[model samples]
Target: MKRSKSKICSNEHAKFIKQYKSKKLTILFCQLGLLILFICLWEILTQTQVLNVLIFSSPSRIVSTISTLYTSGDLFYHIGITLSETLIGFVLGVGLGTIVAILLWWNESLRKILDPYIVVLNSLPKIALGPIIIIWFGAGMQSIIVMCVLITIVITTLSMLNAFQSVSNTKILLLQSLGASKFTILRKLILPSSLPQFVSVLKIAVGMSWVGSIMGEYLISSAGLGYLIVYGSQVFQLDLVMSSTLILCVLASVMYLFVALLEKIVHRRLGL
Candidate 1:
């Protein structure tokens, strides 16, 4: 009887696993199908003159522009410059933000004192400060990176500080009752409990970082994808503009996917 029951349970588990895998595969297929359908529709509309080819610039035209860029060896160079600036700024922003969050969490007095200032900074238009930033950092990659960091760091700090403060008061009291030191409580309880929020912050940071880098490029870059868009507009090269925008979309999507993958890994490690 026991052996039969165990065998039945095993079969049910196997069936559940198969269904889950099938569902995932179906979702993936649907996503790809949707993207392909959209592209086909876009191309067809442009070809039929239902959409202006010059303005909408069909996928074929964008592909040709990309090919031209690749042939001229400019494609990878622009991509590399933008990618490196983004990555550097992303790392710095997240790192510095986390440290600031920790400091704020460690000192209630300091947190309160700086709370208003942080809010003011967050509310201020970052772009409005562009001229000042350019003057201070000069018109170069440094300025661009500073812009990216400035955009991302505040949000990261705020998100993380809230996450830290959101820890269960009951759990914290329990730790205190057990005579755990503040640092011990933070290390074991606060950090682990905030892992999900950290992942959420990372996801937000990814998008913000891209926005910052692109905005910075628009301000003063001579190279990079943003530069391509600005130059294309000035030259009235709609195809180039569309192609650069498409590439930016692709790159941002890839970065978001990486953050999603990281979230999965973190969850798996935590047995979530």
Candidate 2:
């Protein structure tokens, strides 16, 4: 009996380890394949001169350009400023947007009253607000933050409000039948049910937050990935343009991963 139990335990452990190894190997292979394909395409194009080395830039040239920038340590400051703007704007927008959502959820009458205003605000191109924000706040971090908030908050608020209100009717009724208070119903039923939607909206808001920050940099103010791209383009420094773009993509991907991790944690905790 003891030998049989030990054998079963060893087999289960081996199977789990094998599964884990396979997953890691799959991820590694995919990354390796993509890297190989990208390098091959770059080398082929450069060899053929079909891709202008100076214009499109070979991968080797871009690496050299990155090394030069890294040695100068100039990219750190630009990256810091842009990341600060993006993170702050994202936090403010999502926080305020959530508050707005909760408030709207609390009062259906208020939501109905403000419905048209919400439509108008959402329909108004957030980019159009850039000039006004600049005029109101006068060209700096404040205007940029405002633009980011303007873009992300309204949409988040609308989505969360709808999601909260759309919680399962049966769930709400069951809570009511248990003589639960409104707060109890919301706390146990509505809020929990709306979490999946919140996670999705958070992902969307993160993208919008990046958009707002970049647009702000594009329209006004001095430093950011967007500014670097514009500056690089004007001077025809394709390497700098490419580097800044890579930085933006990396930053956005990190933020995306963060939200994804949060979603996974939520699912695990809720047993979803």
- Across 1-272, the per-residue lDDT of candidate 2 in tens digits comes to 33323333577887887787799999999999999999889878986999987788777777787788778886787888888988898889988998898888888898889989999999999898788899999899888889999999998998988899888788889889999998898788877888988898889999999999999998886887889888888899888888888889999999999999999998888888
TM-score, per-candidate, Cα-based: 0.87, 0.84
Candidate 2 RMSD computed on C-alpha atoms after optimal superposition onto the true structure = 4.5
Best by TM-score: 1
lDDT tens per residue, model 1, 1-272: 33323333577887887787799999999999999999999999999999999878899999999999999999999999889889999999999999999999999999999999999989988888889999999999999999999999999999999999999999999999999999999999998899988998999999999988999999999999989999989988889999999999999999999999999999989888
How does candidate 1 score on lDDT? 0.93
Clashes of 2: 0
Record all residue pairs in model 2 with backbone atoms less than 3 Å apart, i.e. clashing. Answer: none
Model 2, runs deviating above 4 Å: 1-31, 177-181
Residue 10 accuracy (lDDT) in model 1: 77
Least accurate 10 contiguous residues by lDDT in model 1 = 1-10
TM-score for predicted model 1 compared with the true structure: 0.87
Best by lDDT: 1
